[model samples]
Target: MADKLKVALAIALVVAGVVGFYLLSEQALVLRVLSVLAGVAAAAAVASQSESGRRFVGFARESVTETKKVVWPSRKETVQTTGMVFAFVVVMAIFLWLTDKSLEWVMYDLILGWK
Candidate 1:
């Protein structure tokens, strides 16, 4: 029951923040933005008390930790792999073009005599 109420309040806070932004449009842009941010912080604080929100926060923290443990490829390895991929693509393009031209020649020049 308490968790449900906290979640609802969090949603309400976010909605109120959006409304406030529109309502305070006549105010200075910086002040209005700060107010909206404060509302978002409040909403986050309220939401963090809920079970689902806590789980999400834990998941985000774990994701960051796992990201840090990743072994990224070095710059040289990345560049070399990229160059090889480009070379293979060019070779395939040339091969496909030759095959297409050969088929066109056989169909039009030799078989149909349309040339």
Candidate 2:
């Protein structure tokens, strides 16, 4: 029940911020943007108090840690992979074009004799 309440409050805070931004239309752009940011920050703080929020935060941290451990491909490997993909695409395009023209020729010049 408390967690639900926290979530609801956080949502309300976000809505209030958006409303504030529109209501302060006469204000400067920076102030209006700040209003929205403040609302979002407050909502985050409120939501982070909930049980599920804590779990989400923990999961996010774990994701970041796991990402750090990943062995990403080097620049050379990336470029090579990209080049291979482009080559394959070009080859496939040429093959498809040839097949299409061949079919068109056979259908019009041979079978139907429309030419």
Best by TM-score: 2
Q: Report the C-alpha displacement of residue 80, candidate 1, in angstroms.
A: 1.1
Residues forming the 10-long window of minimal summed lDDT in candidate 1: 30-39
lDDT at 17 for candidate 1? Answer: 85
Clashes of each: 0, 0
lDDT by residue (tens digit), candidate 1, 8-114? 99989988888888999999998888878988999999999999889989999999999999999999999999999999999999999999999999999999999
Q: What TM-score would candidate 1 get against the native?
A: 0.81
How do all models score by TM-score? 0.81, 0.97
Query: Which residue segments of model 1 deviate by more than 4 Å?
Result: 110-112
Tell me how far the alpha carbon of residue 103 in candidate 1 is from the true structure, in angstroms, after superposition: 3.4
Candidate 2 has a TM-score of 0.97
lDDT of 2: 0.97
